[model samples]
Target: MDTSRARRGSDFARLSRRVAEAGLLERRPGYYAIRIGLVGALFAGSWAVFAAVGDSWWQLPVAVLLAVAFAQVTLLAHDLAHGQICRSRRTARTAGLLVGNLAVGLSYGWWMDKHTRHHANPNHEEHDPDVAPDILLWSRGQAETARGLPRLIGRHQAWLFFPLLTLEGVNLKVSSFRALRRPSLKNRAAEALLLVGHVVAYLGALFAVLPPAKALAVLVVHQACYGVYLGCTFAPNHKGMPVLTAQDELDFLRRQVLTSRNVSGGRLLDVALGGLNHQIEHHLFPGMPSVNLRRAKPIVRDYCRSLGVDYVECGLLASWGQALRHLHDVGQPLRAARRA
Candidate 1:
């Protein structure tokens, strides 16, 4: 390890000790109960509205509400994957299957495999799938060597970012299906079955209740809102933060903290993002409950400051601006290459 890595390891050890001493690692069952309760209520309410709307124009607004509810439930699924809610690994996997595969049509097995790697090596170009090369160029190296459609998209990615987010729901569903085809996924059969059931129940109900045109419109609205809401919540977490390469030797604390950007806001923002506004703390302690992240934030921030590590936290709007600026900056070289 490098000198910085060594220092970070030492700092993390101290921080861990302080956190333990302060009892910050203890589970809060009541908080989680309240959160799960509210999420369940929202999902129920949204579905009830959808069922009541039938073929009326009110279906569009109901679809939007349902999309928001789905996004919120997804956050709970994220927590399940981290074992924050269900401490038992077996129980957590069960919860993940129910929430991710059954409820949201995402494969829990695939998500666990990808998310575990991300937690272990966040922002790493070679290891973290979140930052892996795609149609959008998020790094200078990726932009400089882009070709064909990717090159064209990279040139105008900043402008296209939000528009493209509208398709993220479809992208995620496709990714889940693709993941099921991989031989390495252990629970492939179960996951595939649950996803099929979810599709049948979800679309079957829509088509059964409404005309084909109305059903299509509701699908579009729901997916668009779901994608955009999820994208908005995730974009600020790491988009403008530091990117790690395969060669970096940073310790766990440094790796996660340096690559994560926290959004600053009060309880409203906290609830909106499912406590992900405390990105740095969440990354560092992935198993910690979402409700506890706020309390841990000041402790983690102060510890990092004392160690001279950069801990980025900014207002929500500023964080979004930073992400857009970074995307624009990365696209500049691609645009110049196209011009040439």
Candidate 2:
């Protein structure tokens, strides 16, 4: 194999150009239109079901379903943030802010900046704050030395912390402040409004109903559903993959492509996960409009093989197992800084 085809991080400018020429960096408007419409329908449908339940015996299930729908909407919000959900950057940003803040209860500004950084410096100990917040630094010593519940939970399941984050107020606070600190005054204001709306909606639901217990039950059920949906959909991408170094951009893209597995079983995974099942292709050609990811994988795989890199493909069960094994092997916590 001609390993030289793989670019090193030192050749980022050239590599970026190649990625463009390969047609992996463009977005398809039609796909995004469908995505927006479908997710919107799911959200509307979930809410309708909830409303129809009307504090009846099925109210809990309905609330939980609504939360799941809300979490799925976050996937669309992510695509919008990547500018894959729309043609215009402004439109994408607007949609991202709206969906992320209102639907998923996250700060759009914060998520945009943070996720952008993740792409820019994936796995960099110094740059990827999402790498590992509280885990012990494996490079420093044995993985056994890591501290706290974050360490104990392990990487594969660490995503479970996402739901707990909602209650801890970390997601809302850190993301909100981060957005406020940036140049996006509009995003900050939008997020503020969404946050207030979420609170008011929840509180209103609680007060509108007769008993406080019923309201608490609704909140718990809803958040739990959101947590499960959010964690599974987002956690598998990088948790088990190697961290990309400053010198590894070329290799990183290739590795990201090779290491990132795709889970293709049915339409639910495809639509609900927003083509993330083809994550390797998606990461390698981020701007290529994810709708084409499934089709692009073979081309990407051939190209990767030409470069002598490995391509990993698996179903959800197998992928999940690999994720767990990777976490078990690398018991050390992720580094929390960007590389120089």
Residue 222 error, candidate 2, Å:
1.6
Taking the tens digit of each residue's C-alpha lDDT, what string does model 2 give over 1-340? 5555543553335545655776767767676777678778989897677666666656788777777687778777777777675678887777776677766667777777777776766556557766644642322232445556645554433344444534433344355655665675565677778866766775675557526777678777777667666656655665566655456545565555644666765676777677888877777767667667777777767766765667777777676666655555554343321121
The lDDT of each candidate is: 0.88, 0.64
List where candidate 1 sits over 4 angstroms from the true fold: 1-7
Give the per-residue lDDT digits (tens) of candidate 1, residues 1-340: 5795566568778888887787778877898899889999998888887888777988998988989899999999999888888669888888889889888887888988888998888888888888876878779988877787778888888899899999998888889999988999977888999989989999998899899999999999999999999999998999977788867778778898999999999999998899999999999888888888999998999989987889999999999899999989999997787679
lDDT score for candidate 1 against the true structure: 0.88
lDDT of 1 at 207: 94
